[model samples]
Target: MASNKSAFVDDKGKPLRIADSAMPKPGADDIVVRNHAVAINTIDPAQADGFLIKQYPTVLGHDLAGEVFDVGSNVKRFKKGDRVIGHARQFLTGQPEDGAFSLYSRVPAGNAAILPDRFEYKQGVVLPLAIDTAACGFYEEGYMQLELPSLDAKPNGRVVVVYGGSSSVGIAAIQLAVNAGYRVIATSSSKNSNLCREAGASEVFDYKAESIAGDIAKAVGDDQFVGLFNAIGIPESFDVVNPIMEKLNGGFLANTKPPGKLPSFIDAKFVLCIGDFGFPVWENFITKALESGKLKCLPEPKVVGKGLDSLQEAFEVRNGEVSAQKVVVEL
Candidate 1:
């Protein structure tokens, strides 16, 4: 087994080298995973470009699918050789821990979930962050609080709109809403319409169309949607959906920077998935959902190339590509 391997970003905000280092020893509450695949998220590029940069030469991956090679003595949830997914550290805290870019990664026991037998490493790798984001939107502070007054009533066949439906978070939102029996309408490029449909969206609107919001309103019958989930945090996304939001009965869930002024009629809730280490409820909900397969994993990630040598190329590809699929690196 290789002792240490990582893809590090240089001072110029570019991926410079994949080098060898010391492998981490498991702590009493941690497990070491022999990584098979690592999934890329937008946050990867953001960190690389200093959007959320904390330290230089930081390892740049969050999601991974692998097998447990060893566990800390206090860890009881997993055994050696068990396939698993490593949840990203939401709050970096003060640790300089290497992320999933390396061949072996150490994660807390509560931050790892056993992969279902039906999923391959690639299929399971993209889910941890996306699922957590969706779970945050669905539940309250990480607990599965299904107490929304709208859900408790009789079948009103309420509608929920998900903007940027082709994104990983959008996909998870659609699935979670549909599984909860809500009618889902989503907006995405025409090319990704099929993916939106496959994720259980009742209606898919071409976001690139000139009258995209109008098209969504026409389909849902003028403000029939109860909630709106904005997976894309762009300012234009908020503008396009604002009109429809006026007609909704409930609030909106946004994954962008929190807005300063609240909108009328619709409650706008900004969802920041990470940066909260004190919330044990959210972690528990995600762990249960993944283990139970209530939250289905994304399709097998498209591997750019094998090993750390391909890191820079992979980063470039990820930064430029706009596919609905998740980009992954094989270790």
Candidate 2:
């Protein structure tokens, strides 16, 4: 059994501290990973500020890149010593031990994806939540529900507008949408425009420009644009999306936040990415895509500090604006 030290939160909204936690035992389909790196997400702080906790002294990590230290009897996909990356299910399942801030993390085999040797922990750690969140907005039948991405496909003339393209979810959306064969038009700060383009977006617009809406309207004119994927869930971005949605003549609008009032002409839905659905994408393509350079390690990791002690500071950094960057803590 792995004795553990984790960044523990004594209560909701409390600062995280390194503390001893019980070693998490795996279920038949789970694997215990020894985390090498962990990344912070805005949702971590948001969860801390909310009423989601069912227990105190809970762990709070989100994204992890690590090695499999042990596996359950029924787990067949991974073996001891394999390097893997996975989305911690604590927030989704409300289980403290399931978080990934510790020396070891217990995660379902389905939620874990194998990472290529060429990429280090930091490069691959940013993907789990980003990929899961983007998939929820893109493939859930109630959301965009576009066709699943295929490896051997070319552009199909369909287009998607990804708002906040440099954010973690936006980067993942750009790649996934492109893999599904749709042309992507994204919005990002000019400094990070190339990152979005690197993810396969054909055209990227500056969200700060006064003429942004007109720019998007011109590029998507009468083209088969399905809708906008709002990665930045703030209310103000709706103004950006609405005009483009109007120009597209009422397509779909999928967001990472709670669904809000939208024009009746368009289909708007809020996507809560349940972690279970993320496996298909991970098992089927993420590994290969990374190897082939189709999917990228994006919003590059901005290391907050080293060791489990740095988690609190890392979480604090996420409370402010972090454009085209993922705050990570290297273990």
Candidate 3:
């Protein structure tokens, strides 16, 4: 075991400072990882500003990629020296216990999956958050059942729209839908249109265009869209997409909202992604997709600074910047 320093914000809401914490011990179904990289997300700043509700003095990271340093006796999936990535904390309380923004992390064995030899730890860090979000959005309980269409058949040519296609969650959703043979149309800034197309979108539309829904309808034809993935979660975006989406028979919209009422003519499905949904559901699929080359890694996050001490600066960059790429801290 190794002791490490962690960056944490005090109650005053000032910049995070390094504090000493004990090295975590692995339980019977746990593996201890010596962290190599941790990716920052939009939620980090909300948590920092106390906008996103969570336990105070909490370790804030969730997406992690690193090498296994130790394993418990019952951990049969991974051994020492293996590289893996998964959920940072052991449970899915939405409040972090010990997070990945530190030198070492103790991850539950069931939540960990081995990284492919062809991929680096930094690239692997981008998988968990996106994959988990997509899986939970599509298959979580009480949502429409996802029955696989016939193997030797066409997909009834149904259209699906993904808002914010360049965002991490939108990228994953587009790829998943396209691989499953659905015709996907996505919205992105003009600069990210090529990237969205490469991710398997049938067509990319400019979100800033005054009539985005009409443009999508013209491309895919009338009343063809059956589902929507709103990765951006903006209230105005929902207002814009609702009228066009109402044409479908039983179309549904999946978003990150935490249990709230949706506008008329649209059914909003609240997705809470965590270990409770069966950790292996996403971890297994992502590992196989990586091994088979079905899923490609996002651009390597631009490293702002090195080691745990740089977390404050990294957090500042995450809060201030409005770019498509993730900000990662190398440990």
TM-score of each: 0.82, 0.96, 0.87
lDDT of 2 by residue, 1-331 (tens): 4588888778767777788878888899999999999999877887776657767767777789999988999998899999999988887666767998898889888888889999999889999988989998887777787777768878788889999899899999998999989999999989999999998899999998878888898898777888799988788988777877786777788888875888887788887755566678888888888888878888789999989988888888988778888999998
Clashing residue pairs found in predicted model 2: none
Of 1 and 3, which scores higher on TM-score? 3
lDDT of 3 by residue, 76-195 (tens): 888999988866762244333357776777777766788888988877887666766766666667653342322222555777788888887788777767656678899888999887
- List the candidate 2 regions with Cα displacement exceeding 4 Å: none
Report, for every candidate in turn, its global Cα lDDT versus the true structure.
Answer: 0.70, 0.85, 0.71
Question: Candidate 1 at residue 18, lDDT?
Answer: 76
Candidate number with greatest TM-score: 2
Global lDDT of model 1:
0.70
* Candidate 1 local lDDT, 28-48, one digit each (tens): 988888888888787777777
1 against 2, candidate with superior lDDT: 2
Candidate 3 clash figure, as a count: 0
Query: Which scores greater on TM-score, model 1 or model 2?
Result: 2
Lowest lDDT 10-mer window, candidate 2? 271-280
Alpha carbon lDDT at 241, candidate 2: 79
TM-score: model 3 vs. ground truth: 0.87
What is residue 143's positional error in candidate 3, in angstroms? 2.6
